[model samples]
Target chain A: MTLSTMRFTEAHEWLRPDEEDPTVVTVGITSHAAEQLGDVVFVELPEPPATVAKDDEVAVIESVKAASEILAPVDGEVLEVNEALADNPGQASEDPMGEGWFFTMKIADPDALAALMTEAAYKAHIGE
Target chain B: MAADLDAARATPLTGMLAELGGKMVSYADHALPVQFAGVMAEHTHTRTAASLFDVSHMGQVTVRGPGAAEALEALIPANLIGLAEGRQRYGLLTNSAGGIEDDLMAARLGPDHFVLVVNGACRDADFALLKAGLPGLEVSMAEDRALIALQGPKAEAALSALWPEAAEMRFMDVREAVVDGISVLVARAGYTGEDGYEISVSAQDATRLAKLLLAQQDVLPAGLGARDSLRLEAGLPLMGNDMGPDVSPAQAGLGWGIPKIRRTGGARAGGFPGADAILAEFENGAARSRVGLRPVGRAPMRAGIVLFADQEGGTPVGEIQSGGFGPTVGGPIAMGRVDAARAQPGTTLYGEMRGKRLPVEVVPLPFTPAQYKR
Candidate 1:
């Protein structure tokens, strides 16, 4: 899916809502963040069914040159993790918005996604 | 060479590196590129092809005079008297307590002249020590020269294409070579555990020489980020990280650098600094030993991670000296100094990362196989 329909955080995390359930959102780091991270070698995603508060550390990405935390945007419980990254973490850089999605979470508030940044806003935020 | 890496703000190639899209970072006090193509990409490229690194920030000094080698031997614990011309030996300057003051490369340029390559941050102190330690010897720090390290499997092919004399040299051979009329000292040695050369050229010709090397089909530009990972994979310890004024040469796993000629009961024995304690450590063993560590998983167990014998941890048994993702080794690797009892390879230890104890095992050094020409 095109990133135009996705929501973004100032920290560069992007969330996409599943059509079947608006409250369930799949999240991944934006391409800008991936590009800035150089090469992603390791990823630590929260276990499914684990509840996290908004802005809590939900995942971690370790690159060859750096380490960074991925915070949860809106409180939620992790629904599923992309286990494929355990085998090939670089995929996060190749398809950051789609196949490289980090996790799917059952967001606490269905309307929280609307409050996040839009595609144009994200581009402006990153000064693209 | 540079004066103090933490005080030296720029190198001759700073502008060139920045113009090439290098991600410049304040390394120590110097502005150096952390990566160009990318740490992982540059690291991988250096494994198969060649990569040029700007190492001008390291200290370059020359101690020359009659009996200069003999005078230097009093401070550095290497067999410098027998260090024949055109040969290079790794040198470590020890302290009164046998702790390593600094690590260096000593090359006998001539019978009465010897050149040294030392760590940038420790240069000023090392030079001052040399001046005081080698009385009547001309100890001079070369400021007009810039150093470049060219490395990889194809390094010979790339350099030999430019200077046919390159193929004739093997590892650890040091000599003067001329490239495009640029008179430079070419040492067939480098930090990376690959077949490589360290070229000492005048600052005025550094940019020009670098451009020529980069034009080679096999050579690409690499920065300090890749240098760290490559050296770590090679099992070479970085000073101030794996060693310091408080770590003995033996404790730093650099005891091998002390040759028999300089050891106790050999010619010129026990004349260098901390000879009593260092020789004792060499024979009896140090309290702690430097070792290679595998973190068992992908997450990098970086420096500052404490090590313990038990997961529950009564007290820390060791600490990581240097660590990062081993792009070639394909996982996280680190070097640490652990208690002598837990130094054996295959011994499992726990490294506390982010308040979590991760399973780590002592592994054989040089996580990736070394391809040194020797």
Candidate 2:
């Protein structure tokens, strides 16, 4: 259930290199986050091109049971949003690292990327 | 409300426990809710493979009397009299005003004995309702039994490997099977619209039975999270969410359960409380019918989202009652009550969510086609 290619933030957000645009890091919810939220019914993604600060809320996932916020990983302008999520929030679970990738960011602080958890570290941290 | 269930949890089977490294939350107060692995995965796995669900929290009650089936038929809509020995039926107990008392499954074990599986949250109230409605029948709340559903196309294969005789039973049938000498009542029925069996066993034997099933190659442990999503994807209605007292069976699209034989005038057959209102709905089309909805964008259309004729406010047409992202369909889907005129398949609509009107469409239900093993 762990995606080794993705880096995790303590806040439960995950980021990875965007295949369509390698320099852009795609951000999304981690599998653990989706599991915790249970049945996700609604999701709202910030519009693409919106400038965002690190830790800013970028998306919302609502379940019949609970609602959660998805935060940003870096201070940058949003390049594109996963519009598909607006219709299928379960994407957060099915392909959290790929098609479910929330948004892409042009790194404002490439050095901050060093602060994220390595695949092994996140697995251990979440006790996966 | 929780205190009521807390009292019932004093029994061994009702004590909540977390299994398989899954996280647990307070679901219906007494039961531990497994929210991990996602509802979609747990649900889809149960349909194509085998899933172990900790339904130990559901209420299992036995009613016995010379007229048990007749007593139950007088309260619920299912044709209990016609139910063959060792068969089950999904039924609804309703009040005189046409309000649902509770949705339950009743099984006939012998000529004058039956078992009722009721919703976890509604257990206490259902017991009270049954007692008041059928004063002559003896009802025994089997609080010591745990229920586990082993469901999917691979369910029979996996279960039969352990107890080969179960593979031959058809849908809605029940039989007594023993695994490692622990007795179980296996019923070929489930809420997820999948081919499965709901196995009832003593609480002390639940963990052992579950472990045995999970050890099998095809079985996976799923939680309530997946149970809800799977049932939604199959277009099945959840009692509290999709159909409550405010909603009638006709409006919820469950009119087919009413038998035509019951409609005839003679001895009046069953004396169900809501017979008049339900029969009227059957004769005359319902004012509002439940319809399947698909939003146009990637964001999900959720409950309370107002249904409008168009994005520019042609007029409020209806509202979403239940909505979710269907993992199997890979999109957002929902059920809503709308004007009969606007309920046709492929009709365009809009869902008002958070001050924004999103484009949507009216689609035929079962968002994803059901794969029930008939």
Best candidate according to TM-score: 1
Give candidate 1 misplaced runs (Cα > 4 Å): B1-8
True contacts kept of each: 0.95, 0.43
> Model 1, B71-151: lDDT tens per residue?
989998899989889999999999998788899999999999999999988888999999999999899998888899999
Give the Å shift of residue A31 in candidate 1.
1.5
Cα error, residue B185 of model 1, in Å, equals 0.4
The per-prediction tally of clashing pairs is 1, 8
Residues A6-121, candidate 1: write the lDDT tens digits: 89999899999888887998999999998888889999888887999999988889988778999998888998999999889988877887788999999888888899999899
Task: State each model's CA lDDT, in order.
Answer: 0.90, 0.77
Score candidate 1 by lDDT: 0.90
Worst 10 residues of 2 chain A by lDDT: A33-42
At residue B121, candidate 2 shows an lDDT of 78
